[model samples]
Target: MSLRSYFLSSAILMGAAGIIGASGPLQAKAHAAEVSGQPQPLPLPPALPTARDVSYGGTITLNVNATDLQRHILTMQETIPLPPDVSEKGGDFILLYPMWLPGDHSPTGTLDQLAGLKISAGGKQIPWVRDTVTVSAFHVQVPKGTHQLDVSYQLLTPVSPKEGRVVMTDAMVNVQWSAVSLYPAGYFTRQIQFKPQVVFPAGWSYGTALRSDGAQSGHTVTFKTVSFNTLVDSPIFSGKYFKKFDLTQDDKVPVTLNVMADRPEDLAATDDQIKAHRELVHQANLLFGSHHYDHYDFLLALTDKLGGIGLEHHQSSENSGPRGYFTKWDKTFAARDLLAHEFTHSWNGKYRRPADLWAANFNTPQRGSGLWVYEGQTQYWGYVLAARAGLMTAPQVEDALAEVAAVYDGRQGRMWRPLIDTTNDPVIAQRAPQSWRSWSRSEDYYSEGQLIWLDADTLIRKLSDNKKSLNDFADTFFATNNGSFVTSTYQFDDVVKALNAVQPYDWATFLHQRVQDIRDHAPLDGFSRTGARLTFTEKPSDYIESYSTLRHVTDFLFSLGFAVGKKGVISEVLWGSPAWQAGITRDQELVAVNGEVYDADDLKDAITAAKAKSAAPITLLLRDGDSFHTVSITYHGGLRYPHLEGKMDGLGAILSPLSGKISVTDHKE
Candidate 1:
């Protein structure tokens, strides 16, 4: 029978019971039948249900009242109809209440402390197996048909400190027995044991990252996966939603969005976000054959406290963040860009499950040495898509690239390590914290790896007509590898092979040379420079200070053998000495030296070099008010340069004496 037929059949068995005490008086009803004479009629006790019997091809039902205070409960009295071929074999049925809810990252692992787990079958309490991890089980004769397993337990709500200010908008709450129960059964590599029907706070709408399978009076979200094993790991979410965007393609592949928001602004932003995301997904679909699922949904929630987080599954993507995060320019741009990043995972994580990801044991450590490609390559697409979608302009894209470049260039870590190590060693891949020196062995896979991808993208564009770009390779990668599952997982070598299969150049040699060994940086210089340029102009102000003190120092140190200004810029030409010899400079503008900027640090590197090696020459690029000129001077060691000495002390102690001076003020105590 079809799922609808099953649901209809089950709904008939459930009958149309008026939702007791939905918005009315709460009272106790007893279930005691009859009593002796002269006594009042006994009240009927509340109904409770429990699971019993596991025999194949059996049907069972139990009458029970689910607990809900404000709203009526739409109890689905349905059985998990296993495939006909699989026999009723015994195995551990695991159940787990995710420590972290969808889009929430707070430490909620303690929620397993539930109170009074009781199961009743036919007005009689039944003994079931219990586990230490807050799970229960029932051993019974295997039955086929439909089985009504009723489980009732009390959930203690956590009182948050930021309650009034915090809000969870567009939230999709899904509760499932099989999900919570992490049980393994037969040959079925169960992803999640029980997927609870959602129980959200009444009046709050649902926005989930899971598809909604149409059901009677409610929605049923069926998970679609190439492999049953892949499907099992991806969880399902269900709840009421604020806004729903149905992107179902002519009834074949379905797409829907469940949107929630804390404020009206959030809804407005989400609307815009959804519109942009639709186009992006459309673009991604061009590469992959067809979305694996019939319908796709985004469980999007805008929360005041919940920061940005996206956990992608097969059919749905869960995204949550602050309400204003998607409205402000910088924050919104970043948030939307991140959403795209997660969206790309539909291909990388969902379609092409990493070899390490095949049997992803969330309980154990996940080792993905190729995260540089997995996460890093995917990260590269976030900004690319954002720009291509018009959310970010080409200039903004260049600026973002500049930021990444500057970060990579300034980092002390990259100097000592190669990016490929992250792909080679699982320890470095997982980012295990080592000693300060050892910790510097790995750099950000996303930043540098993205640069690599960007560089490759430039090369691809230059090598091939813009007609054949990374998009083509992306399409080819997905088409050739989509849904291959276990036997044909894509690896680093597979990616290179794919690129080389259609490329005009030696891709592996290029990857090894540029990615493995550092070369002239600006691999995307042609694209970036053409895309954006910064115009710097000096602005004069009346509040500028004079360099009289520096001149005075120069004059005083004349006997020490340092010319005040010789060359146009600061230049320390002495080798092995303070200035060139000592590594000091002549006329280099002392913008900032030794962790102190020009304002706080009186002496610059050029001046320090001059003082340290009095007999050396140095260059300085000075910008005092409207004056911008290069100056160089010669130095001969002797009298200690007070500015240099004090500056050195500050650098050593991380405290500049000039800036560290304390003020005397009136104090009470």
Candidate 2:
């Protein structure tokens, strides 16, 4: 409103009050008493909202005005692209303006749930079809051309844990614009046209969708040309901000760091980070092809509390937390490692992408067969590229490799299942309350995948006399499969073909047999065990539990009577087996089987045969704690030992025994 209009309204209201005051108290009272029935004063006029101008297939504007705490007005105007099939068949389109939270991955909020709706098109008062308990999906039937559309509604901003409304109070809003209706499918989109222009209360800037319109002036700017695919992936943050380093290299992409925090020194840390990250990027570019982006920006968002998150994108990655490594670790080294891992994503997971996700749609599942390559190869390079670029020392890489190797060797159950299977499985077997814990115990895809890549790379290098490495194959794969938004259909096949072409060897069979199948024991024992040098082996000083005595007795029993069930759960006491031979019955719950209990300490002992046993017959006890009796179990024979040998560091070691004394160079052919 203008200053003149404000003055005029103020003067009218004051003049009316003065006229009433001028009427004396006695005269006013007499007049009120005489006027028994009179018409009420007319209500003030309602506020009018401004209409937005939209161009292209994405001209949706929402003016959500919440000047008061009770009533809010949400005005929407959108222009969406109709599919060719829909346009041909005269398909009806339903444009929905569903309410959603900023961080919520799914739009299932109750704010948009309504009993009725009122809608109009081009100022025509048309009857809006409504559904009970749902805000109607505005059904619009239009020809296949960009047309100006407008929608406006008044809604109540429901009170929430994050303080009433996310957008109004926080001065931040995440707007989603898609071609498909957003009512039923949780706001997921296959195609979107443009990023919406955001208007915040003055003095706030966005955290995401780094403005293509330049620095926002006076709290309003139009984000003119944003593709729909990029809209869903981008989230915006508007609040207080601090500027970090703005890195500009001669031939490389510029790096901008926006540090939003309460502290000023938070921006100071970027001095070293900018330098270190630039060096790291330069090093990676030297190894891999150019990281093709105009510029790269990192948003270092520091919330009030400690935060641990790094979400990646083509041009930017969000890094938020407390002071973090910059405040805690050796600033130089830690920053280098952190930057290397995140920056590597620009090439691998971001550009190279999984073949299965070539035509990925947000609402649907796109399962790819190349987790082994995408995740595994990415893992391989994260460390390899760092080492090659001199960002990490050779020993540091080897140390990291050993840690990963040990983790893989320890968790063989992951190998039992493919990287895909475990990912698809439910956290709980039966949708029970405690199912989320299932993932905690499951095998890590990245860890196992990395081991596979290492093994594959090693074989490739050795088979071709170092003439053909995995890197060559990867470059070809990227060239062949780049620009794909869905999963790659021929990535794996093409990679295998390229490998065979260059080496002229049947490596696909090797990959399928060794890498694909769990049973194929693609041995890593030959990969040098520098354990004695790199790791410590401190044997127990006193009486450590004895496995030798129990192994012999258990081996004898396995030969005689007991049977092992799937997953190593000892199932039955055989009819004439040693367990049965020792007077064990059908319902006997063995507490201490051969002096080993069903606990971690005892379980490891059972595997190692560390629990001591009687020289002759063994007295096994069954118990529901204190209420059970002893079942006499006599040992007869032995447990089968699955043993295999492989050469490493010019020396041989038994794989099953996992002896730490194996040579480190036995595998180098």
Top candidate when judged by lDDT against the true structure: 2
Candidate 2 C-alpha error for residue 604, in Å:
19
How far does residue 29 in candidate 2 sit from its true spot (Å)?
85
lDDT of candidate model 2 versus the reference: 0.43
Model 1 agreement with the true structure over 579-627: per-residue lDDT tens digits: 3333344444444333344332234333445556533554444554466
Q: For candidate 2, write residues 1-669 as lDDT tens digits.
A: 332344356567765664556567855764675596644343242221121222223334433322332232233333334444445554234444433321122233344523234434455533333222234344444334423334444444334424333232332232223211232212234334553555554565555544545635555656645554465445444444455466545453566655565454554564454565555555555444345345666555554332234545556665554443344323223223434555565666666665554443333334445555655566666666555545454444554554455434533343355454533322222112221121232324455666666666666666777676666665555434332333224566676787776566776776665455654233353243312221212121011111212111122222334433223333344344455556544333446656666342343344334223634445555653357666654442333222212323211111111112212221210
Q: Which structure among the candidates has the greatest TM-score? A: 2
Model 1 residue 556 lDDT score: 21
Cα lDDT, model 1, residue 597: 44
- The Cα local distance difference test for each model comes to 0.43, 0.43
Cα RMSD for predicted model 1: 22.1
TM-score per candidate, chains pooled: 0.54, 0.55
Return the lDDT, model 1, position 250: 30
lDDT, residue 222, candidate 2:
60
